[model samples]
Target: MPSIQKPLTKRAWVRLPSGRRLNLLDPTPFDFEADDLALGAARTVRWGGHSVWEWPLSVAQHSLTVLAIGEAEAPRPLTAAQKLAFLLHDASECLGVCFDPISPLKPFLGEGYRQLDQALQTAVHRRFGLPADLPPAWKKPIKTADKRAAAAEAIFVAGWSLAECREALGIRAAPLSADPLTPIYGGLPWEPWPARIAAERFGAALAGLAGSMP
Candidate 1:
């Protein structure tokens, strides 16, 4: 069957590496591949490229760090859906941008930005057999894990002192000194990784999570 035609407006079409044009205004689960999400995320810089490392931290790496942090803090092992959520939390940011918009700037971008993100997120969730929204049981732990990930990244990669993280970044909780991924990924703990390596590692995890889904 012929795929649905692109939206009338030219701006709606975003061409992917596989030559599939995703309609950002109305995305579908089949619009992209896991590899596409992984590569896009690996290239999307976090902390606005302000990291102390040679290369800026990528969302790919941050997602994994968040997973590791979540595992360390969880009362029990995270469900596969929850783990998938953590890995794909920032997947939408990778669609057409190379940088994550800082929290302060998201408001100015208006509801359009918010809707686009939600649309893509919904598609991402359905694509992997997850609920359109995160389960309530999963939210609190993921939020805390994400914050902890930020705290760690701020201090270790972005050159922010712990005090600065508290006073300036408003992360009151303490950051983790040891990264859970160190044993698996084998790098300087919490340091930013090159985009290529980040993508490769992220791809491995993405495949595992997606395959685990019923």
Candidate 2:
């Protein structure tokens, strides 16, 4: 069970596996169950050049790829714990509504969303059996992978012509490479891959780490 302080009414509300039913209009909050909220959030968060039909690059997909990149990009091997951290880094957005850099809701979200975002992040890490905090070195590279995925998405999945993406999004067209098993823009409604493919890829990377242990 996890909770966030409802800013408008000043009460605590439990966010269940499903992401629904908060104390938006109530004074005293109650618990609600809605796991699909995270999945919906994953689909809703859009970057520039959005399309209802085109399979946009999802946070879930980016997260999975980041984990793959982390394993490949690590100077030596990465611990299981490190790999898990990369996989779950954006899990917070699963709780709060995902917003793009230019989305208007971002500024309007204010303090309440920020607090809820932090709470969900911590909860997701704990749920995955990862430490609540991530290492400083892992932070920059994971973010680089995130951006790299975004760059790829902007060019490939989001239907932005390379020149249009470069001029509008300021994202350069970079070479795309990753673990062979990791899916690249596998399918639309991208959240499914996390519970499906990402879990396996993460496990394989961790196994590799263990084998390299001295």
Candidate 3:
């Protein structure tokens, strides 16, 4: 089967030791390029889990959530730039996952996806003028919030039983309707959430982060 083609500039491709390639655009060359790449990539997908119509959450929305959580949990004050970095954290996934979660191909996810994702992340950070390596101190909090989001998602969106989730996560499940899961991608019928809605959710989460700051 022929794969879908994405438009790319030659400068975007950088060679790796393993002979793999990456997209590492020069940050200063384009204005708002990071945002543009992220926003554009969010519109499509490579692989996503089974849900209503085999749908999955979009990277754009997820990045927004991460930003919200970062703002809410970051111990030290973050500049506007840092906040943007947080929101666009998963920008690489905007293109597609290095590997997607699914049966028959699940094993590829462990090391293959990890290396690719890390490279993409490094490239994105360098492109956006952020540090190449994530600071160690911030790691745990970000990961914790990510897991909490996962837990919340399993109960609300994936149709997991509360008892099953409780046994897995060791926490009582709460009412899911209050924080109803919004589908990032549309179904085969193609009923997607509005881009404005995605932006709004992102903005609100970013605001919440500010509120959580000391």
In the range 105-169, model 1's lDDT, one tens digit per residue, is: 88999998899888888988888888999888887888888888888888988999989988887
For candidate 2, give the lDDT of residue 21: 48
- Worst 10-residue stretch by lDDT in candidate 2? 25-34
- Return the clash pairs for model 1, or none: none
For residues 104-206, could you state the per-residue lDDT of candidate 3 as single tens digits? 3556568856666666666666655566776766556666555555555555555566787778545452423323233433332222244455545554554
Taking all chains together, the TM-score of candidate 3 against the true structure is 0.57
Error of 3 at 4 (Å): 31
lDDT of 2 by residue, 135-180 (tens): 6877887787766666665555566777886787777636354332
TM-score for each candidate, following the candidate numbering: 0.92, 0.61, 0.57
Local distance difference test, candidate 2:
0.54
Model 1 CA RMSD to the hidden true structure, in angstroms: 5.0
Overall local distance difference test of candidate 1: 0.85
How far in Å is the alpha carbon of 85 misplaced in model 1?
A: 1.0
